[model samples]
Target: MSAHVRTPGWFTVNVLNRAVAWTARRGISVWGSRVLAVRGRTSGQWRTTPVNVLTVDGQQYLVAPRGHVQWTRNMRAAGGGELRLGRRVEVFSATEVADDDKAPLLRAYLRRWKAEVGVFFHGVGPESSDEELRRIAPDHPVFRITVTN
Candidate 1:
C-alpha cells in the first residue's frame, strides 16, 4: 500500500480547524484540541496550527495525518515545542516513533479522531488490522510527547 498524504481542504483549514482552534484557545478543549507552536525550521519563528493531541496509556502523542508536514519537520529539527490552550501552554519534547511501533498509537488516534481526520487515512480506520495500519505507518508520523516544564 502507498502512503497517505492529504492536504487540508478549504472547509478544514478555514472553518472546522479555525473553530476548534478558537474554542481551544479559550480554554475549551474540543476533544484534546490545542494550538501547536513550533519554531519553523528555516524561518526560526514560531508557527502555529491546530492539532488533536492524543493521549494513550497515560502518554500523549501527536499524529500527522497530513504526513511530513511543516510542523512535523519543525518538530524533528527543534526536538520540542508547546501545546497551547488559551493562556495555558505546556512545553514538551517529542520523539518520533519508529514506523513499526506506530500501529497501536495510530489505531487509538483513529478511534478518537476518525470523524475529523479519517479522510486522510485513506479508508483505514481504528478497526483496521494491525498489518493494514503498519503498512501505512510510514506516511503518518507519530510523535511521543514528554512534558518539559
Candidate 2:
C-alpha cells in the first residue's frame, strides 16, 4: 500500500465509467467487465464500480490499474465484495497480492486489457520484461479472489 493513487481522467471518471457501469448493470460484460459492489470503508454503504476480471491459470484476479484508488482501499477494509454480471452476483473474499508476486498477474492483465487500460500503466505492456513489470508493480494493487457463494 505504499503506492500512490493515480487519479483518472475526466472522461474515464465521468463518461467511460458510467457507460461501462450502465452496461454491466444491465447484464452485459464488456471485455470481462463486471460491476464490483463493496461496502465503503467508512460509509458502510455499498459502492459500485466497473472492473475488469482477469483470470490466469484458473485463478481470478482484480488488478487496480489506476493504483491505490478508493475501491482498492474499500476492498482492503471489507475483505470481500460482490461481482455482479446482470442478475448473477458472485460473492467472494479477496487477498491482496504482494508486490513480489504481482509481476505475472500484471503481465497477464496487461495482455488482456492493454487496449483499454494501457494508458494508466505508464507505457508498460504485455511485452514488457518481468523486471519492467516489477518496477511498476507497487503502483498497481492486485487481489486474488475466491468465490464464496
Candidate 3:
C-alpha cells in the first residue's frame, strides 16, 4: 500500500476552520487567509477550505503545511483554482514546485504558520537547514500561484 499523509480531524475541521473561513469570507485576512476552491478530481464539484496564502518576494504561493491533503491533489489535477477573500476572487494557475525547489518557500511558510501547523513538519522550523527542509518537501506540497486575471 502507498503511504498516505495525515489529515486534520475533529477540532481542526469543526472549530478552527469554521472560524478562519468565517473571517476570510469577510475579507478580513487573518494572516493572509483565503478560501481555496478546487474542483474535486472525481466529483468535479468545487471543494473549499480556508488556507494561508503566502506571498514571498513578488510571488504568491499555496503551501500545504498539512501535507498531501485533498486540495493539493485536486490542484494538481485541475492545474488552477480560485482564491476567494470575501467578494474578491482570484483565478490562478498552479505549478507544483519540484522537491529540490521547495526549501525556501517551506522555510518561509513555517516562519509564518509554524504555531498552527508546525506539528505536521515533524520538528523542522524556519531556522532549520535547507537540507532538512528539502528532506521533508515531498510530504508537503508547495504550489506557485500565477494569477490568470
Ordered by TM-score, highest first, the candidates read: 2, 3, 1
Question: Model 2 segments beyond 4 Å from truth?
Answer: none
lDDT of the candidates, in the order given: 0.91, 0.94, 0.92
TM-score-better candidate, 1 vs 2: 2
Which 10 residues in a row give candidate 1 its minimum summed lDDT? 1-10
Q: For model 1, what is the error of residue 20's alpha carbon versus the real structure, in angstroms, after optimal superposition?
A: 1.2
Candidate 2 lDDT by residue in tens digits, 41-85: 999999998999999999999999989999999999999999999
Tens-digit lDDT track for model 3 on 1-149? 11448888999999999999999899888998999999999999999999999999999999988778889989999999999999999999999989899999999999999998899898999999999998898888889999998
Count of backbone clashes, every candidate in sequence: 0, 0, 0
How many clashing pairs in candidate 3? 0
Give one digit per residue, the lDDT tens place, for model 1 in 3-36: 4557788988899889988998899998889999
Pairs that clash in candidate 1: none
Off by over 4 Å in 1: 1-4
Model 1 score (lDDT): 0.91
